[model samples]
Target chain A: NSKVIQTPRYLVKGQGQKAKMRCIPEKGHPVVFWYQQNKNNEFKFLINFQNQEVLQQIDMTEKRFSAECPSNSPCSLEIQSSEAGDSALYLCASSLPTGRQDTQYFGPGTRLLVL
Target chain B: AQSVTQPDARVTVSEGASLQLRCKYSYSGTPYLFWYVQYPRQGLQLLLKYYSGDPVVQGVNGFEAEFSKSNSSFHLRKASVHWSDSAVYFCALNSNAKLTFGKGTKLSVKS
Candidate 1:
């Protein structure tokens, strides 16, 4: 019964404004992931961190987004200088120590609207 | 390269009716497949996953998926669908443990 909690369920940012989303992984989970879902119902993986080290990330994340999972603190995904295209639901997920069989638990997601 | 394809963009089924959502994949071998559901305004929830062993695996919410290696498909099915089954279903393929998701199929269960 893993539960991932996210802060500020809703977010609105103007073009070029910064947007930050936070996620508290389930207790003892060491893997965290960030994804962007658009109106088209397509999900794009942004980045993933194993403990405090990043394991994998997409090109889009490297350009506009930065995510970090500091020791014992909630993981944060920050979008710097958000553009109109950056407006989408950003979802955070966490998984237990197991990599293959562990089902990732997701947060409620932070809906970002960049106007 | 690994990918997941859910051909139907939308599906409507009556309550208590049997349901099947088609999902196909393109990978080198038996890949890690998963079915996830997303209710309105909620993040995705895992319904089931298939890694190995039995080709047919049961998941939460009475959902099950069958893996056919020859057909390269992992279709989701339910014996009797409930009205609360209305949601977007996504099929995912993990290549090298990196998740690749499909454009979800929106399922609407009618009363």
Candidate 2:
């Protein structure tokens, strides 16, 4: 079974409300990635971290999304003000640095509904 | 920029029948290919990945994918699929430490 864990399998928020979810990556994995899956099943890359350092992120992430992976705490992604368009499945994945390509393992994900 | 395209939006196949899902990608440099399967209300599970070596790579549950640099295609295949294989399959390209995913192909297996 995958070890990556995500809290609150489902979340609901009204427009302009703040929404947050957490993730604990698999043991020993240093790379964490966040992705958004819309109802159409289209995936959008949100952000990624390499051992608590931001590696790459999209523009929308800078505006309303805030994420952090502290040393001893679970990584969290928070939307400052939720919009109806923000309703989607948020997936978290972790990968170990392998010298070669790092294969990412994913958690079950958190489904968010913005009303 | 790297992008992936899964031409077929949905595919249906009978149990015990062969299966194939086509994927095409666009990238300037060498590409890393991966196949991921997402069950209902769940995150994606990695089916297989291709970094280097042989063009064909095998994954769990009898799943396999072939990488064709010439055609810029990476297609998933299974000799005989089980009904439990019903799910959405995504084809992704890894570049610059990020993954660009295709829209995904929804597979429905019939008994």
Candidate 3:
């Protein structure tokens, strides 16, 4: 089983409200990733971090989303203003990043519902 | 750009029957392929991964995948699937530490 943990398994927010979720990566893992899974089962990669440094992020995330993985603290992803279309499941995964092939372990994910 | 394709959106099979889930990927250089299963309301679980060496790789719960470079495919298979195997299967390619995933295929195993 994966040791990754995500807080607030379910969240409900009104439109234009802020929505935030947190994730705790597995111990000894230095890489973390966040993704959004829609109701249609389509996955979109949002952002990733290696330790406290940002690696990659999408254009949507660059605009409305903010994330950070601080040392000794849980990683967090927050949206400036949640929209109805933003209602989806947010998944967090962690990996060791061996510079070759690395398997990522995922958490249960936080399901967001916008009203 | 890299992309993964799962031809089947849904697949149904009887318990104790063989199974095959087709997957095709598009990438310029060598590709790292992976198969992940997601149960209802749960996160994705890695079934298997293929980097190099053997074309056929074994995974947990009697799952296996065969990689075909010429066909640009990594197809998942199982000898005898149980009802518990019913879930969504995703085919993904790893590039630049990012995962490109297919829409996903929902598998239904009837007992």
List native contact recovery per candidate, as a fraction of 1.
0.55, 0.55, 0.63
Model number with the top TM-score: 3
Model 3: what is its DockQ? 0.74
- Estimate, for each residue in A24-101, the C-alpha lDDT of model 2 and write its tens digit: 999999989999989987888899998999988899734899999999999999999999999999999999865337
Greater-TM-score candidate between 1 and 3: 3
Candidates ranked by TM-score: 3, 2, 1
Error of 3 at B94 (Å): 0.3
Point out where model 1 deviates above 4 Å. none
lDDT of each: 0.88, 0.92, 0.94
Give per-residue CA lDDT, model 3, range A9-78, as digits (tens): 9999999999999999999999999999999888999999999999898887337789999999999999
Candidate 3 all-Cα RMSD: 1.0
TM for every model, in the order presented, reads: 0.95, 0.97, 0.98
Worst 10 residues of 2 chain A by lDDT: A96-105
lDDT of 1 by residue, A1-115 (tens): 3399998899998999999989998888898989899999778888888999998888773477888999988999998888998888889988875665567778889999999
Q: Could you say which candidate leads in DockQ?
A: 3
Interface RMSD for each predicted structure:
1.9, 1.9, 1.1
Using DockQ, rank the candidates from best to worst: 3, 2, 1
